[model samples]
Target: MRKVVFHKLCAELRSRALLEETFHVTIEEQVAMFIHVVGHNWSNRPIAFEFMRSGETVSRYFNLVLDALCILARDLVCIKSIDTHQQITSSHGRFHPYFQGCIGALDGTHIPACVPMHMQDRFRGRKKFPSQNVLAAVDFDLRFLYVLAGWEGSAHDSYVLQDALSRTNGLKIPEGKYFLADAGYAARPGVLPPYRGTRYHLKEYKGTREPENPKELFNLRHSSLRTTIERAFGALKNRFRIFKCQPFFPLKTQVKIVMACCALHNWIIEDGPNVYVYDDAAWYEALPRSVRNHTDMHQENLAWAKKRDDTAKMMWEDKVGQTVP
Candidate 1:
């Protein structure tokens, strides 16, 4: 980390009195220890060896830093209003007008977890490994807007999404705003998903064949935009190695780490250097394929389906003049 960035963090924490210098340890060292543990998934023993401190001391400071970072979550993980003017000029600007009310993309990712033997089965998913299902929503800037962790890995994406929507204060969509999700989720009034039985992933569009119809065109654009959340997840795991592997911590601590990592991710995007670049293809290839049951569309679902169809038709008509036969 740069000196300026380090000092800025120290200033913020110091102002909040969330972190302070111990008898022999400065706030800088404390912050460095926490970053090292999260960034590298280092155990207390190895961290103690590196810092020349006792294992217990290292563990204590680690908890303090973890708690402090969690306290900053409210300020870090926040959803911003969509900027229509900016979106119209963005790299994916052509499709911006069609999804003018889109807030971000939503998806679920599985992170390895360590649970008691009796509870292991509930956390084990298709990967045959115990894990936790983490649902995250991210905007175009690659910042996490909302994150819901701690769900058993065996939980389905749609189930987790329903949980998020059911909570009184959980993931809230504005009156007209919607979020882009994949087929694993049920398309509804507040969420837009690609048309089923259609090419969605970027790898599917590698050949000379392009979108043949309006639905294909809508799916093509949706895939392009929804990819931002996948890239965000990739960037998050890449920066925090703890998320990449199962850390030797209690289930509660592990869950907190997930939230803290997300909070830090947003902080880095807002204030840190712009060195993080997302590899869409790499992330897509790493994902595990799971079979999802087709959700029966009901009354509300039908209305949402009609809305999606209308949007697809509008987009196709707007670009029909430029499309080759």
Candidate 2:
């Protein structure tokens, strides 16, 4: 800065300004990421000093960015760009590529957070740590359709969806049109979750009895659709390694960073072909069937638990509103 001062920095500033202007995503997209994902430890004195021309710039600009992401997520309808096709088959075989008739896969991920002293207990979840459970829904092409935030870690995945659906009525998929999800979600008309038991690609088996006839067939069909989401999540965490780390910030900051990483994921997938492929075979081969079965049974079951679980869900659903599409 001392050597180059205004002249050289001005040119770089102009380039940065121009870059920001061209994207269709509003300034919120820029700001949210600037704070949450791109600028972690931004408040640390020396680190802040390194990035900002002035010390106060980060704080001054932080809320400005936060407001923008909020607006972008609420108002913008993202139109996907995918090449869909259909194959010629007289009767039996058909193959082509498009969005692959896959709408989206919904999942919940817990982000570690610095919970407030007063409410820390409310946020402690499965791992016995303070965290925030964020629920996001994405299309088969791995683009985010909707993201709902502010869910407590202890809350069930089904509860998260119910809250999002009730709060945002527009998200209701039309009749017979469904978004695929793991068994963690509730079973309703427009949301199709996998059937319990048995196996399919990326499916984790729970101890519940294997699904009967048509349900098994439905899961088989849905597996092809849902894999995209898993792949998308894997790519996202891999690229933004910090997201994989336990969040040790305020709950509010956790939300901001989560959204930022998601935007970053979309940005990369849209701009390039760096989508990640998971080593599911490696993970599966290393894990025993009994362990996999035990893990799957627990994690994939937010909808129907055992007798204790089922009863809890019944009570929880009453408190957590249900929206039928």
Candidate 3:
């Protein structure tokens, strides 16, 4: 985080009465300690030593700042607007009309978690170690629209999304608008996923291996646009060191930390300096989309599937017409 953005966050916290400066420790120091801990993944003892304060003091202020950030998240992590995003509007017919109703993309990520041995079975899944399945939505600009963390690693992505939608204040998809999701999610009314058993990932269309049919063409374009969420997750895990290892905090605190980090990520992006490094290409290479469990039998709706087919046919027809001699 930049110095200007740090001060801004502290000022915002104070303005909202989320935090106050004590005689022994100023709000700035308290926030700095919290940032150091999350940014460096330092434990209470080491953070206390670096801040020249007792371990108890470090832990107290860390939680205080964390609570404040969580409150701030309600404002930061949200949709910029309900209007059509400029990225799609300015796509020069690439995605303008076809995906104009797309508000953003949603995906689930596994954040390493530390749990007791007795409950490890429930937490262990695709990853070797236990983790939490965190679902997040991101717009074209890489800002987080919504986040739902704390689900066990063994939970399926579609199940987590269903839980999120069931919540009162969970992700809201306005009428006529939807989000692009990977095949891990069901093709519901407000959710769109690429066709299965088709060339979906962008890497599949490299070099001269262009999309051959309407399904492949639509999948190619869908994958290209849906990368926004992937990039958001990439930038997030890249910036915060805490995600690199399993946090020793309780399961509840671990979940709160994920939410706080996402909020802080948005704050730094919007209010702070724009020093965020995008691992667009590198992140894709690290985790090939082909390996994802797209083969899973999701409860795809017929209406949504027909909508996808219509969009793919339109896109393919346009491509064919433009290439005519």
Best by TM-score: 3
TM-scores for every candidate against the unseen true structure: 0.88, 0.59, 0.90
Give per-residue CA lDDT, model 3, range 48-140, as digits (tens): 788799999999999999999898887777665656788888886588789978989999999999988998888898999999999999888
Off by over 4 Å in 2: 1-43, 52-54, 75-102, 200-218, 245-250, 272-325
Per-residue lDDT for 323 in model 2?
A: 30
Cα-based RMSD of candidate 3: 8.2
**Superposed model 1: Cα runs more than 4 Å off:** 85-93, 272-298, 323-325
* Decoy 2 TM-score against native: 0.59
Stretches of candidate 3 off by over 4 Å are 272-300
Please tell me which model should have the higher lDDT, number 2 or number 3. Answer: 3
lDDT of 3 at 300: 33
Error of 3 at 116 (Å): 1.3
Clashing pairs in 2: 28-68, 28-69, 84-98, 206-297
Q: Which candidate is the best by lDDT?
A: 3
Prediction 2 global C-alpha lDDT = 0.51
Q: Note the clash tally of each candidate.
A: 0, 4, 0
Candidate number that wins on TM-score, 1 or 3? 3
